[model samples]
Target chain A: MREKILKAIEKNSRIDLKELAIMLGEEEINVVNEIAAMEAEGIICGYHTLIDWEKTSIEKVSALIEVRVTPQRGQGFDTIAERIYKYPEVNSVYLISGGYDLLVSLEGKSLKEVSNFVSDKLSTLDTVLSTATHFILKKYKDHGTVLAKKYVDERLKMTP
Target chain B: MRNPLSNKITTIKPSGIRKFFDIVSEMEDAISLGVGEPDFDTPWHIRDEGIYSLEKGKTFYTSNAGLKELRQEICNYYGRKQGVVYNPMTETLVTVGGSEGIDLALRCMLNPGDEVIIPTPCYVSYEPCTVMADGVPVILPLKNENQFRLTPEELEGAITEKTKILILAFPNNPTGAIMEKSDLEALVPIIEKHDLMVISDEIYSELSYKSKHVSICSLPGMKERTIVINGFSKAYAMTGWRLGYALGPELVIKQMIKLHQFAIMCAPTTSQYAAIEALKNGDDDVVEMTEAYNQRRRFLMNEFKEMNLPCFEPFGAFYVFPCIKEFGMTSEEFALKFLEEEKVAVVPGTAFGDCGEGFLRISYAYSIDDLKVAIGRLKDFVEKLRAEK
Candidate 1:
């Protein structure tokens, strides 16, 4: 039931509770309790809308920063990742494989602002040895959804 | 000038859905629940395989039976999924689509005046195809009380010395009914006693929601007499790929290959290659699509209950055959009025056959949002009709 609920709400968290229960073939109260329990357990962290900000009039610039950081005494990469993710501007922080010790993604108003953050705040932190920042100019897909034009149903209105 | 059409061809009526399609096309801003195909695009990986085959210039006619590798994969798929084994080299014939497989099977198996028992409220092509093959079509009107399943008694009554083949399609189109193993077991003895051949159309096999679909061919003593027709259309969402195949006794398949060789030369070369990839790596894709369909099926059943509509819960395929007899109108009248008043188009059950009267075949292939909007209008229409009553 947990897996079913997560799979159902993964793409559309705003699904009606009653409809979700019906779709899962479960009692409404059981579904409600299951969701509440999942929320409390932090298995379901948060829900956010996926917007193609490029379609909006607002100016936003995004970049992915790969940081190679020296491991601090006992904390290793966890402390560094937490510290980087704590900033309001940072969207995600991960201890990554390959050449990078940590990967951070964030958005800002302009390319200049994003670059300023990388040079000013991110690189200045202790144990942060070097960083490579790559700006995102286009987003063809995000979070399993294609950000292209809306899909029009090409099938005929009626068929057999 | 002499008439160009054959007398036999002229006698066949055009598809009933084609008439309704024309009506719905002219209406602007109409939401339709009348499609008989999946709403998903062919999975990208499968499409990529097709594109890659083309890029490599593998675009030529395969052998009359189809690509050997694809035939082998089809056999492997059947063996793994349904526990039915076949010799790919001798027993498989790939065709343009499941529709073509149906035509080919009828043409190859039926002699003039041979009778083919077809359960009604099925896909529209069976009766016409049987007629075109010079076979008489025996209609078995399945009962709603039986949930549209073919019973052993029904089978016993329909059989005669002339009855040669029975066309069985489950996860049935328009009705969404499926026969469990027990259901198939009951009919097998009668089939064997009558020495009848079975053409099991399992095109919607992957979309079954109740349990794993049981092929009639898999039952004991049934393999030699059953021709299983399946394809990538509903399963992998590759309807436009035009690839389907049949597996059965080597002698029957040899005849089908001969006719297919003369008529089609081969199934599309690129599609055959893509289908190999589908059978090899498409299991996960089928599972995901079937899960989505099942969810939508449950949602529609619940909505029908809420609206007080009389619909038997269908456990296979993506259609709900809801009975609309209480409106004091025919299925056509209810459908037409519903479209005119609510601008939500659903297929009248009579389009499938006369037995489909008083029912509407509403496809749940659309997204849930579309379904919700369409059903909201349906609730209002039903309320108005009840108030008038």
Candidate 2:
């Protein structure tokens, strides 16, 4: 019964407690409580839609940006990074140790807009020392599946 | 001593396509169009050369960068076909497959937090590989309205200061989209202005229809910034042969080769020999096989229309991305139900990315007999689903 519920949740994350109880021949209260426990335990990670973003026409742009930064006096990497992250154009930020100090990734409407953000918004920030931007050209694969290698492996077994 | 499972490895979800394929593998005697490989066998002449090389005991590893002969052949092949040429010794480094070439290219170019722009709905490796390289993968979702081709305006919109590399896979996989020369012309100026590196995977270079495949490297001043990745997999029916090559500036190839040497040593010797043969005499084979795929392509498109699945005709590559959202189920739910009810295995589009949620990628690499059976099963499955309601 637990396995069935888990499998159902894996398939349709947004399944209501009532539906799950009906499918599992269990009480709704019990199913809801189990889901609550799973969420509290972190087993139920997230409920996500397989969004077809094209329908929205939001024109969202995504790019990965490499940033180099120097820590400011009396402030550490996080402090400066926090300031950079506060920008509306910056989507995600991480401080990585390697060829660069802080890695800043952002999205914007145009190349000039993104470039200007770097020059005007990000680079001028107190601790941001340098930024190297690279635009994405094409994607062959994304997420966990090789869209091209769908069933290339004839030997992969079914989820029984 | 310990059960030796690392947290990182355990946490990463397995490939969703592979997961579905695993399910299909358990069924008894189901004809499938689920495979992503070419239906044609590797050309006989190429196989013979590989066999001959083994008979002659050329069994040792080649140089870390791969055999000099294969690189030169690749250079000549690209020049003859795609109007791009790189110094074989300096610019070319043969890899295990286009897959490895992509991994190595990302690893070499990206710093821990660097950003990589990836366009979708696409093949599945770019974003994951970026993450593994400790780089952020920013996805720019392409629309079916544009035939799933990435516009230059879209490319320009996706760049930011932390962007380190752009991976361009064309004569694309799932969508069968190709970037014509005109598209490349539109994209070059932005790339030039940004001083960004372009990794172009043209592994399906020879499989295009309606227009020839265009290499970003063919554009003026673009060669220096572009890394052209190709392999014998799709065109020459050499998927298992496991040979591919990446061509780029010497510096970039050098770093990539260093990573390749440490991690992989060299591509398989037998496969390398087969590739040399493929590079030399595989064009006619590619032409023949592509012709067959095109025929199947037409058949599948008509089937989708007749079945009322609403598919866009693909211009290149072997797969069709058919919109399946009308089924009122997510792509995964539909794929699973279709497999269970009809026993016809197809990949859910959501396996590619979020934008792919409402569609399915149907490969034409299966024989027409198998495709016919699969399509029939799908028709029945849809009818049954409707009837039950």
Candidate 3:
């Protein structure tokens, strides 16, 4: 039931509780309680809309920064990851494998703003050694959804 | 001008869905819950395999029985999933689609005047295919009370001295009915006693909701007499890829391959290559799609219950056969009026067969958002009809 609920709401978090219950063939009260428990247990962390900011009038630039950081005497990559992720501009922080120790993704108003943050803020950090930043030019797909033309049903209205 | 068609072809009635299709096509801005195919595009990985095959210049006519690798994969799939074994070299024949396999099987097995017992409401091709094969079609109208599964008694009564084949399609279309192992077990004795052959179309096998789909051929002594037809269309959302296959005794399969060699030569080479990939690594895709379909199925069933509409709970396929008998209208009348009034198109039950007259075959292949809007309109339409009554 936990997995089922997560799978159902994973694609559309805005699914109505009543409809979700019906879709899962479970009682409404059970569904409500189960979701509440899941939320409290931190199984469901948060819900956010998948937005294509490029379509909007506002200016936005995003970059993925791979940061190599030295581990402190006692504290490891987690301490440094927390320090980087605490910034408001950082959308995601991950301890990635291979050449990089941490991958931090951030959004800014312009490429210069993003680059400045990398050089001035990220590079100045005590544990930070080197950083490689890749700015995203276009998004063909995001969050498992195609960001281009909307899908139109091309199937005939009726068929055998 | 003289007729360009053959007499036998002329005698077969046009598909009922075809007529409804014409009417619905003219109605602009109508929301339809009437499609018989999956709404999902072919999974990307499988499509990528087809593209890769093309890039590698693997474009050539495969053997009439299809690529040996594909045949081996199909056999492996059935063996792994259904516990049914077949020889890849001799017992498997891939064709244009499950539709082609159905026609091919009928053409190969039926002699002139041999009777083919077909239970309705089923996919619309069996009767016509039987006719085209010069075999008499015996329509066995399944009862809604029976949940549309054919009973042993029903099978025994339908068989006649000339009855040579029983076309079994379950996880059925239009009705969404499935015959369980016990259901198939009960019918096996009767079939063997009557010396009947079976063409089991398990195209919708992956879509069964209540339990794992039980193929009739898996039962003891059933495989040698059964031609199990399945394909990538329904399971892998590869309908447009036009790939399907048959597994059975080498003798029957050899005949199907012979006819296919002359008629189709081979299914699309790209589709065959893609299907090999689908069989090898497509289980997760099938599970994901099936879960999606099952969620929508539960949603529709609950909606019907809330609307006070009587419908048998269907465990297979993406359709719900809801009885609209309380409205005191034929299924066609209800469907046409629903389309005209609400601008939501649903296939009339009579489109499947006369036994489907009081019901409507509402497909759950669309998204829940679409289903919610369509069902909202249906609630209004049903209420309006009740008020008129």
Clashing pairs in 3: none
Candidate 3 has a DockQ of 0.86
Show model 1 residue runs off by greater than 4 Å.
none
- Could you give candidate 3's fraction of true interface contacts? 0.91
Candidate 2 - chain A - TM: 0.61
Ranking by DockQ: 1, 3, 2
Give candidates' CA RMSD values in order.
1.2, 27.7, 1.4
Per-residue accuracy of model 2 over B92-114 as CA lDDT, tens digit each? 99999899999999989889888
iRMSD computed for candidate 2:
15.5
iRMS for model 3? 0.8
lDDT of 1 by residue, B193-251 (tens): 99999999999998888889999999999899999999999999888899999999998
Q: Which residue ranges in model 2 land beyond 4 Å of their true spot?
A: A1-160, B1-11, B386-389
| Worst-scoring 10-residue span by lDDT in model 1 chain A | A142-151
Which tens-of-lDDT digit does each residue in B84-135 have in candidate 3?
Answer: 8899999999989999999999999999999999999988999999999999
Estimate every model's Cα lDDT from 0 to 1.
Answer: 0.93, 0.80, 0.93
Tens digits of lDDT, candidate 3, A25-144? 889999999999999999999998999998899999999999999998788887888989999999999888898899999999999999999999999999999999999999999888
Give residue B314's error in model 3 in angstroms: 0.2
Candidate 2 local lDDT, A75-150, one digit each (tens): 7787888888998888679888789987777778777788888788877876667788886544445443233344
